[model samples]
Target chain A: MEDLFLKLSAILTGFDDLDPKLGSLYYKELMKASGPPFTALLQTFSSKVLGHAASTGHPASADQPAPAGNPEDLLRENIWNVMDFQILSQAIINLWYTATLKLGNVTWVAPPEAYFDSLLWRAIEAHPPAVSGGYFGYWRYPPEN
Target chain B: MDKNYDVIIIGAGVAGALIADKLAKKWKVLLLEAGEKGRERVELVGSYLTATAQTLGSPYKPVPAPAKNMAPSPDGTNDYYDQPPGTENPMVFKSTYERRVGGSTWHWLGNCPRLLPSDFKSNTLYGFGKDWPITYDDLEPWYCQAEKELGVAGDHEQLNGLFGAHRSQAFPMNRIWPSYSDLKVAEALQGAAQQWSDFNNEPMVLFCTPQARNSVPYDGRPVCTGNSSCVPICPVGAKYDGSVHVNKAVANKATLSEKSIVTRITAAKDGSITGVTFIDWDGREHSVSAKLVVLAANAIESPKLLLLSGLANRSDQVGRNLMDHPQGEGLCVSREPLFPFRGPPTTSGIDKFRDGAFRKDFCAFRMSMGNDGGGRTQSPANVLNQLLKTDFGASLRTKLREKVIRQFRISFLAEMKPLPSNRVTLSSQVDDAMIPRPKLSFNVDDYTMKGFDRIADVMRSILLALGSKPEDLVLPNHSTPFLAAGHIMGTCRMGTDPNDSVVDAECRSHDHKNLFIAGSSVFPTGGTANPTLTIAAISLRMAQSIDNQLKMSQT
Candidate 1:
């Protein structure tokens, strides 16, 4: 189930280079937030990828993304219109981008060590607000892309 | 804590720390803090990273109920402050202050643009706010002294004769080099300057901001590495905070009592300060005596202390004329990719709008270019949240990077006219220390409203000049109109006449000779500047006066 969660996360988040250790923590948190529904969502996500590969006449496992369809459309097809798939996908994105989980108004942040590891800073070509480790006046030049 | 001391300062903020550092050399000084000593830097950084809302004061320690044993933010949900009735929509004081040993300097943006000469005599020149008793010339020398003490870095040539105020010396260190985004905005504004001629014919300059953060290692602290978190927490000690001077004072043999909340300042019938009673960490009340007392407890807390003790309000001006450089932002996506999230939050601003002859009609304002990318709008975070709502996979990555990197913003800090109607008083609700919380009734006047209109008009012109549409400008909430910059000036104003003011030119209480009140509370009128540099200068001047008096008494 955890392996399936990682495979789905890679496809859903669009970043295949995510740290597996970080993925493990996120998987646990997703289940913690939505226990039975999370398990159900994982099963649905796996079958969609596997079934898509079969229908497309491509050899694919749950580990392999289909050559044709995007993750958003695959999820949105039959069962995805419901809010469950949308919320779960958003939660997956939030876990990678902000290292946070929101059930309602309350947002639960991951532990401190996982803070600087967020992909949000990576996407923006900037470090987090207070955690910049670069030397003096380094911002004078454009960030190294 | 000791029962008696040569001097007892009620707050351990920048003003208190500056005074303590000076006075501790000769007189035995005791600095009493309502909040505990500062928490670890990494702890604060971690808290800021984890905070969901990520408000200004969220990084500080709030578990022990923060200051005087209460929750961190006093203005969080209007639970701490008493806003009068009929204030449901129109007026609310949005700024808040932290109460740790370092005071609100912990979360200050560290942008220290000095007040212009016109700021000192606004009433005499513009017929707007009240004139300060002391002139810019009188405070000029002290400003230089303060820059050295605070280790201010600046490009002196850029702001040499800004609005007719002269600098006696070069800054202690060179200015923090402008960020790449700052240069891009500067180039855009140079093109935009010709268009601003219709609004105000004054030449718009993109001047590098003078800041207290070290450009090079001046004091023991390391140089700034563009942490870009100067407001919440400078992960490294590159930025200057009040705790720096507090350490200096303690090293010089001054006493510091943490988790000690001063409740009431006692006085004799003759109106001389006798002593003060405080509640300690264990909820034990203790009274301490001092030959001299300085109130560096910020604008709100200082006035609340005076009102609590029924002292220093002889002019009925203890808690009147509350003011803040209420700020508004104009967020825009630049035509080109100019990466923000660099160098201290802001490194450059326009001094042309800082002062001019237009003050007779509307209040003057300062224009600052934000390098933090839609700061109050919470750029990268808000952008990511919006993207994640529908976008995922490759599209998500592409949208997030494109939107955040090209994102830019320009914010204005406008001067608010002093109004007695906007004031701070004692609330019916009390803190854990049994002291009443501060109540505020704040609203801007027509003069400030007119200034906002001008600000919007000028912003539109600048956008057009940058080849951007006015529609791209994202302003603040019109209902609130402005976000509090936390200047918090006035309330206990200083003037020669005791009839309408709380303190004298020397910050000596008109009602009590031994009592001296420091901090922005003594600012009769704050111009468009951030008020910290001026706060340091005035506190240094007040310390000089007190030092001379104490020396004379010993002789």
Candidate 2:
């Protein structure tokens, strides 16, 4: 679970060094929030990417010791190399951004906390306008870099 | 259960609230709202804060029973309004309104431009569409009263002669300061006008918009703090909404029953409205008898009710001649960092094309400049995904920052001509309460489309002058065309001819003497302006006429 969490976090945030504890909590919450089908999809996506990394002479196996240097770079490279992994990676990225698990036309709205933690806000450097941003006039200034 | 009242307003939106606030002082006025009584301002603000997709309806919670979501439904099924097969240009007819106590105003942007003098005389001057029963001069005083009531802020001098509207008084408050993007755009346009003759033309001035949001603390509301969330919800009560008047009406002794959706309008044999029947959330039916009935239930719902109850159809115009401001937008990246998305969603607009001989050929349009920088484009996860595809590391972060700061967008809302064929009828599909849903058939005619085509060029020119390349301007085409501006109008249009219009000069239905209608639904023609201010002004005028008639009958 920890390996899968780190691998998924690396794909979403483009960083493997993200706080492991926080990553694990987000992964657990996301799995619960996304329910069974989507969580299974995420698990499959992580294993495939990690398996590809293992074949590429990298120590990405769960039983193997933590690989030297950036594991995210290897996973990201494998993500772009494989077509299905790329699609799944994009879907996982979208899951963080929209906080929804969409299968065809059906969608399950994610919990508010998931939306609050969406990396989309972090990428844009601004909180959702009416949501968690500060008081009335806080938006008047450019978001801090 | 049956209850009696001096007057029963079918909606608790701005129109009904304004009318009830005035009439409740001397009469027993009842305001029936279809949805839940809205929460306090703070609760709405909180909802907006946590909302995942902060679209127009984000702040307010939707009613539990099936209703339209503001954003387009994924499966192309109508959630709010049902559009049947064979409806022309049905995709462009999308609109969503809150059924809550405050109605759509809870999600309104608070833009309050008055209709031009020519708007009332469109048929007489342009030889198309029906002329309004009343003129701008007739409603000028009422506009001032409405502005005062709504706490409108504006630069009066900038608005002078823009559309030939004569104001009897200045705005209630001074204009909100323009954002950096607005100032940069205005400056760029000024420079471009020197080189381009079209920019110097009459009625083409870019100026501060008169808005209903407060620029200063007035009427017990705080000044707008540039929340940039005005459309979905105003975090503070700085923006004017129907709830303000609704609360005042209740305070003035008007009775309000929320979650009571009026389904039928009963009338006597002589075509005089007797009472209305409504169903509560619990599925219990109730009836309210009134001396006078005012149907302020918005454009679609009011006409749907009339068709359902089989009342006010003397001329067969209850749900005909539907109109809305069909709009197209352009996105551009400025060479300089304009830093959009800091202030209100919009602060200034270009109105030179609002009126002219150009109307003889096609529709006129208003170019509203947005201040949200690239916020609209960048905020969407899909668009951001596209933007982030090129870079993966720190380069991705740099690209995001650069693109967001320099992005600018503007939209053109073209005035659509009223067509009887473009109408709202009752759908076969019924809700849980068994009320028939409204099915709309709408199409933007060649006249409006030509206007859209013309505005595309103007939009591109403005973007180019603002430092965007011709290739960089993303303009709409036929395949991906104008969207609904949510200013639904002309369904129950008002005019001098009772045979052609649903209501008379005073907005009193020709068939029912004691029945009145309010809101944008009664507009004879929708001009190139937002319609809420006009809705308020017309409601105030109707309230006065009703008061006078009641007093005369008493005497």
Candidate 3:
């Protein structure tokens, strides 16, 4: 993954500057590193920006802790998930903005996480307070007022 | 002869609902509701436009109008009537109360507090407001029964004059959990009570006010999620709507006739209520016979129904002594963000001044502060300014959103005593059905004002103690026409005698052997606390009385 990021970084940063042979070599390496389905560029962005917090392993928690289920653990996992998404999503959005400027239109820029983040935040505020204000702001709407 | 129903109950609010549920086991019961069952009303329920209804639009649509133009609404901007006072009668002005199957419960806050012991004998002790025929001791058992029946959740251990009434059972459920704001005010007042020790030293205690609303899973109902929007409907079935009980009664085999707007009570030659005549919304009239009749149509409508039926006119006090708790609103902003929109409507209250040492003229209690954020801004001038300032696009939305929303506010709900002069009467003008509309002529007396001022001072002091700035406080004036507190009580007051009042100790009307009244409308004086608890208590006793009467007639 690290090697793919380095190679993808080289291509995105200075695709015009690379020799034809070097550029083809880097492109082949990107394809191999990313595996099937997702492009090397998408994988690099997701791992660095969106998946970073989940990799850190702070789990999320449940909205309401009931006696029946492992409600407490559920609550914790939910919290981690929410925090992970917010931080990762925002970071990726920021990285995309920078990456897009350097890569130009020659390469695709993934949709910024800020769009999804804003939508989620709006929904959270509109929801009842009890549902949103769980541990670590899981499903927590940003303060509207 | 084929006998009619054992009891004919009117209205389907908490009072009528409970009584109907109890009586349906043996006696055939006829429950009359003016409106359809579970009808959705968008206005009362909040909307997405702001998640609170736009206050503008057609104000009323009662089969008969609500209390004509009693006073302008509490916000104090619009006239209750389309025209000035004399041009249109006040009774037919606008609808203040809900008229659907559950009645106003759909819009009620669901606070079910019991009246203080002193409130029962206000006339005897304070020399104001008529005394209840029954003592606090007499109604204690039934109070417990009512709490159980209504699925009340309260901390009985922290009740006022706890020893005054002996309960056979504990509350059906526990007290409601406090919102962050409820805890804050309660803590502040507890300290203030100690400071004002000279004012009788009851040590202003704060506890969760008992509410018909669920706090935990009870009787198949869900627990309250602290919606804080109890005044309007709870879209989630967590808060207790009176219709829950109405539905229970129907499940228990109680007969319900809806959309049958009752016009009058038809009596036999002996003055026994032979039947009731009602007109449907489609202009079709139908008469149904019953052996016994009950009037639980609330303070405003109950008396109007009686007057229309010509049942309780002998004393001329049928609907005369209408009363409501006069609120003295004191709004104060906090230095720290309280995040007001994140909790229950009210979770805690100060009860130090609920009774003892306070004269009849003065009454006071601390009401729970609400979350100030999230609800829409209805200040017309502010809305008008936005229209004048900007284009009607994204900028306008952004500006309106920023200006209208406030994240913090704490308000005070001071207590008021019921005076004889404050009342509901029939108006001169008739509606489409030819029945005179209900008129409310009420004012908060100087005594109530004094009590409010004193309480307001204390609240301001408490707010300051909690790091609020001097400029943060705003005291709303109640002298100008504003709303009477939604807690309406006392019109068909309960007493010992048929001559002095309408009903007996058990809420049975004196004149008619079979007629009974349920709810706060039978209260002798509107107490400082919410009356839903006491109303539920009276409903239990009423059901028993009706049952006993049925047994005797069978023998």
Candidate 4:
């Protein structure tokens, strides 16, 4: 479960060196926080990707080394193998952006850790405007290039 | 037994808080709010820091009431307001405002432009909408007072006769520095005179807009630091909100009851308001009687309460003539990097079209330049959604950064003439608390739509001048092209005649002598400016009239 979680995290974030321990922690918290639906999606994603890699002798196989190129490229290449994987991919991305899960009409807010670690801050290249991470008038300066 | 007070002001928004702060010095005052008192400033700032979506109402927790403007409920079960089925332009009439302790100012942008002289006499000048009983001159002193109270910062040099608002005093503080985007656009527009002309062919000029936020640390608040978060929450308390005056009112011996949703107002047979009844979150009812009652519960809720109580309806104008600054926005990429999304959301605007002979043909508008650095229009999330469909790896990051920095948006807030047909009425349905929900019927007339078309032409011209191809300009759709400025006004309109208007010059109801109404609800015509400054000025004037009347009764 931990290895699959690490591989999924690497594919989603496009980062190969993502700490396996951090991925395991995020996976455990996501399952505990979001419950059955999120875990079920993960299970399907693992089976489709890993099962295909084993049959086709792809680098994603457990017996072989991981792909050397961008994980996103590898996932994009094999994304069509799973049905509705794009929806699951977007759901995972939404969790990173809003720290929440939207199952149908209902939305469930993720835990505080997920919210604090959302990738939205890094994408915007600025801390939340309401709680300035710097002194007054710090925004007057250009953001770090 | 019901508690008695000298004065009871419904809604603890800016108007109510100001009135309470002023009148509480001599008269016993009670402020009733429908929402919670909200978290402390520090806690609220923290909540804003971690919010995934920094929407206007994100910092404050949702109050468990049927405020239709809040988050709309799914399944169509819980609604804040009820409109007739197939209402024309439902989105245009859909307004958003907070019902918390400080009311909508919790998310106001602090843009403080005074209404021009023609704004008060729109009927006489343009033969459309009713004229205000009071002129800019009558409210000029109060505008100064409101500016001082709100700690307005502005450049006196920018106060040309463009809007015809003469200021007796300079702003309380110096003007906030314009953002990089504002400077870039202003510089570019300076040379393009032929492209930016008004109806009379007068050259349109860009000037720094007067703002209510602090620029030099007046009133114990720090200067605005350009956090670009002025709308949702000002983390450093640089921008003014109703909480400042609410706190002052509390210090001056006014009792504020939060989470107290005012349900109905009682009036005597002699056409005088007697008392008010409110319900708590726990469904407990409380009543308070007062010598005078002021309904400051915004434009929507105040009228809803009147309709529910069946009071102040003699003129039958209690909920008629609803007005809001219907706005249209256009987005484009500047030829040069404007670096938007950096300073306060807006810092400058073009007031050339605020009033003119074009009023005979179409509505007039105030054009404002946005400065939020692409956070609103083209956020990283939106860019990623578009980029991820094609690009991968480092190319994705490169495209996102390049596209975001060049995005710019400009919006026009057009003045809509008050029509008796566009209104707020009580629906047959009721909420769980048995309170009637407000039903709004609104439509954008051809006059306003024509004005949007003209503004679109001007916007395209401006974008072309800023080094954009004509094809790159995005014009608003005329069929459905209005965004609610949240400047709800004219429902409880003030006028000299009692036949057509709901309130008199003093914002006192024509049917009830002691019943005064504050806030933008009493605005006869909301010129193209944002209505908060005018709301504050009129509220201060109303507070003075109430004070004088109370003093004379003792004599």
Please report how far candidate 2 places residue B298 from its true position, in Å: 0.9
TM-score winner among the candidates?
1
Clashing pairs in 4: B68-B80, B340-B373, B341-B371, B341-B372, B341-B373
Who is ahead in TM-score, 3 or 4? 4
Q: Which regions in candidate 2 have their CA more than 4 angstroms from the true location?
A: A1-24, A30-75, A78-119, A131-145, B38-77, B87-92, B194-205, B373-379, B387-391
TM-score for each model? 0.95, 0.87, 0.71, 0.87
**Please, what are the lDDT tens digits per residue for candidate 3 over residues B1-555?**
223677888888888888888888887888887765633443333231122222322222332343432211212212221223442223222225555566666656677777667777777887777778887777788888878777788887777455254455677888776665555555555565335643574555566777776767877877766544455555455666678788888998889877667888777766677778877666677877887888878887888788878886566678766666655445554544444444465666665556656665566554545554422232322342333232222233344344333333444444555555556666676555555656656555677666766666666666665555677565545443323456777778877777778888877767777777887888887667777778888888888888898799889
The value of fnat for model 1 is 0.84
lDDT comparison, 1 vs 4, better candidate: 1
RMSD of each: 2.9, 4.6, 14.5, 4.4
lDDT of 1 by residue, B244-295 (tens): 9999999999999987888889888888898899987677889999888999
Clashes of each: 1, 9, 20, 5
Those runs of model 4 whose alpha carbons end farther than 4 Å from true positions after fitting are: A1-25, A29-117, A134-141, B42-55, B62-78, B87-92, B191-197, B373-378, B469-472
Q: Which of the predicted structures, 1 or 2, would earn the higher TM-score when compared with the native?
A: 1
Model 1 global lDDT (CA atoms, 0 to 1)? 0.82
Judging by DockQ, tell me the better candidate of 1 and 2: 1
What order do candidates take by DockQ, descending? 1, 4, 2, 3
Q: Interface RMSD, candidate 3?
A: 14.7
